[model samples]
Target: MIELSRRALVAGAAGATVTGLLATTMTSPAAAQDAATPAGPAASPIPGAYRYKVGEARVTAISDGVRTFPMPQGFVRNASGEAVNDALAAAFLPPDQISIPFTVLLIETGRRRLLVDTGNGPGQGPVGLLAPTLAAIGVAPESIDQVVISHFHGDHINGLLTAEGTPAFPNARVFVPEAEWSFWMDDGEASRAPDRLKGNFQNVRRVFKPLDGKVERYAWNKEIAPGLVSVGTPGHTPGHTSFELGSGADALFIQSDITNIPALFVANPSWQVMLDMDGVKAAEVRRRTYDRLVADRMNVAGYHFPFPGAAHLAREGEGYRYVPVMWNPVP
Candidate 1:
């Protein structure tokens, strides 16, 4: 028999260990690759909606889908396309692309069910989806007791009427901010407005006309209903409104279009989006409001934020950061 030294034995064992490890390592990646892949067909995303509670109240964030398009010139009136693209890149969003999302909120206070915003519906293409999303959550349009519109923007008020031009929420009392109503309803303002803005005035008339002075006008800081208070956050429009919901110790701010697609505005608060009727005023409101929200660690929901737009704000540098609420399957 050949004489085997202790060193040779150790070397042989080491070699065996190396070979085993190599074999395992060589197959591990492929095995992991196979495991990482989804089995069968790729699963598609379902209708967007999330539920949470405030005291005894129930709130749902409903999506009307999103409209994506190439970043256009003057998308950000204050910032150049290059700067806007840079912000998009930093956020890991595809550069030079824009996505405008619509959110319709549902608030239930035991006896009353209130909808904060009526999203773009079948009436508006390239966007509308709120109807089906609400249905997905078992809320029929007729079940809504009140519809509190945040502004006169088409995205916020379009769903007020169904595809057939009838009141979607037949039994609901539609409440719009009084200031918004005064400005948009003014024929002088409509005529003096730029050609591009004429469409908005026309759309507003188209949506609110069927109601025929029936739409209830609400004032700033006033309670529209129990636990729901209108917060005037103008600049996007003369009468743009947000809302605050408080129940027990829980409170939430429904930030309707305060800053569209936070990747740009919230990340750079001074940068103004083209949608703001008064960019300067909008930026000021954004900074001041966000500062307050950050200081209080307040919860917020944005109409133009990503689907399920509820989030918290953090003061980052001169701007703010949007921290999306964690997905909770169990309310």
Candidate 2:
């Protein structure tokens, strides 16, 4: 098993709490004012990428950026607006608004490198950070050997193509779920899609049409790449999938949109998100997935989780609690 540690870093001085340190340091009014003012214009925050190990393989969590907005009407189909706000408040998040993050996973075995999912393409507001973050970690797009898609969601597929409508990972082979391809590629299904989903049908074509004959469709329970087995985790989409990433004895579950935002959906598994194609079925799968995670004590890496989104789950009452894994500076 991989050695997991939990060590909290102190903000300022030893034995001093952040609040206490601030109180002592800002005693003078001028000191406080001076503290707030920078000597010169500050630079923009540098985006980050995190890497750790899963057995012998190195796994990096590359951020794609985030989307923050006020909670829209019907964001949670089954829950009342008030209930949704309550959940957010319980999680210590700001009420009335939510920030959904997008993260893509890179798994590197000594022999090959694989990307789990792509992020929202470039130029998307507050997103499209995947490319830069990858570069930040010294990974070039061309070095990726395989691109494994979790589902057909725009956020997960958009990064597959570049601004020029060319394959982003020019040298990589693309693998998609067989079920997902059949559902989205069928004209009959596209024609019957409701207005809200009509755009999704068109968008699917827009992303995949350029990769025709270059794409390889995969099935459930199969190893799409070495040590990476595709697991059928439908409901978010008819062909939505997850993966069991095992290297040696260490394993991590790459949960792709199993729960959109952990605070809202993971804590309240029964509450359905607007993106779920089949809310009821999505709920069922979410519950089942969480139950397994809890029982097996498996660590998970979520696509929409906070930056470097990797954690462990514990059963809390009728739902599950998210416990983030400790960051190891050297892996």
Query: Highest TM-score among the candidates is held by which one?
Result: 2
lDDT of 1 by residue, 137-238 (tens): 346778989999998888888888889998988989999999999999999999999999999999999998888756889899999999888899999999
TM-score of each: 0.85, 0.87
- Worst 10-residue lDDT window for candidate 2 reads 21-30
User: What lDDT does candidate 2 reach at residue 186?
Assistant: 97
lDDT of 2 by residue, 153-176 (tens): 899999999888888898899999
User: Residue pairs in steric clash, candidate 2?
Assistant: none
- Top candidate by lDDT: 2
Clashing pairs in 1: none
Q: lDDT (0-100) at residue 152 of candidate 2?
A: 91
Candidate 2 similarity to native, TM-score? 0.87
lDDT for residue 130 in candidate 1, whole number 0-100? 69
lDDT of 2: 0.79
